[model samples]
Target: MILDIYKDALEYSAKDWKTLVILGVMCLFSFLLLPVFLITGYNYRVINTAVHGIINGRDPLPDFEDLIDMFVDGVKVVIVQVMYLIVPVIVFVIFAIVAGHFNGGLSTALMIIGGLITFILIIVACLMSQMGLCHMAYNDGAFSKAFALSEIKEVIEEIGWSECLMTYLGLVIITVVIASVVSIIIGAIFTVFGISGFALGVNASGVFLLGAFINSIVSMFIVGPYLSIFNARSMGLLYTMQI
Candidate 1:
């Protein structure tokens, strides 16, 4: 199964490169929009007003300025951090459904549970492989073996667990640090200059737009694949150790 996974990944990368790229783009776009959607929905005033009116038997026509103020206040107070928890579960469930469709053994109720487990394991293996790659020197073998749990475990064991964990942790920390810095800079610009500054940065210098595009591309092609691989590798190691 591990070898077959590697073969499938390679074949998919080669024969269906366009499909993979499209899926990657779709994944990136979905993630980017997730926060915006949550924020808009959470801060929606019309629904809130209607609900309030229904409960109190009062007029639903709040003043426009008051509504706007309410929405802004809601935005400030709403726990947008809930998105962090929601998005991953949504993504995982979606991916699992897709995998079940592709694998074609999920029709039966009992089989659905098994299929979901397999999907979760596959995702974990992919993540392990990516972490492994980040630690090791750039090698085609690492990329090729990324989808294979068995091969990934072999590589990890050879390198030792302590080193692997340190490297993986370092990669995660670095990514988080960079993302934090970028967010802070963007937030500062928005604070100081407001919408006008944002427009100028996006339209005049094209910096904002360019940054968003690059971030999406990297998140899709680089980060997604690497994480998938790392997860696969890590799961394989755990299984071997258990045996």
Candidate 2:
């Protein structure tokens, strides 16, 4: 399944090289409003595609068709994520205000408690959000489906909670490793060749700034989408197990 996840994303991107590059370029310039929309739209499409792939027993990184649908689904997903995270955000905000307003033993205690609670809530939210998104996908992008706790729990039970959690953690670790390696390689290349050899000769500050810029390009153009596809494929596989 892991190999399939990697192969699916790799083959899909290879086949859609032109489209992927175009999207990557768009993401490169995503400081503009339109590009931001398209980039996010693409992300939502990934989730949608994962949903379809899971249901169909094949991991397909969807194409860049159905722009309006992708955009709308993407917006809905963002909303779903935000809504799931609202409680944690509120808790942190309140604790932050409290910690700021009052500085004492009581304040210190509150801060510690808040920190622990916030951390727990964040973990729960992450797990819940993934299941919720899968539920939403299963239900044809119906936002309300994400909140169907009983049904979601049943699906989780079918998959086995421990198994699901381990799979998720493993996937997270894999992605982090991939991203770290990509960053290290890109940084080394630019720092050694571009910065040390050229940019630093011109301007030290510019060298660092240029490294950051190039890093963003490599991240968006290659690493980011690759990880996104990999994630979607893995999640789809998880969902498939339940079915």
* True-structure RMSD, every candidate: 24.2, 3.7
Over 4 Å off, model 2: 1-15, 54-59, 97-102, 194-211
Once fitted onto the true fold, the runs of candidate 1 whose alpha carbons sit more than 4 angstroms away are 1-127, 131-150, 195-243
Q: Assess every candidate by TM-score.
A: 0.29, 0.79
- For model 2 the local lDDT of residue 36 reads 64
Which residue pairs show collisions in model 2? none
Q: Candidate 2, overall lDDT?
A: 0.72
lDDT tens digits, residue span 1-243, model 2? 545655555455445555566678877776775666666567656666666664334445567788777777767766777888999989988998888888788889888989999988887777777778878887877889888889888888998888777767777787899878888886786677655656446555655667778787777777776766666556655766677
lDDT of 1 by residue, 1-243 (tens): 333323332222233344335435545565675433332322232223322222223322223245445444334323322322344466657656665666445445535665576555544443453433322212322223324446656666765666555544544554566556655665556454445666566443455555566655655754454333233333322223212
Q: Point out the worst 10-residue segment of candidate 2 by lDDT.
A: 52-61
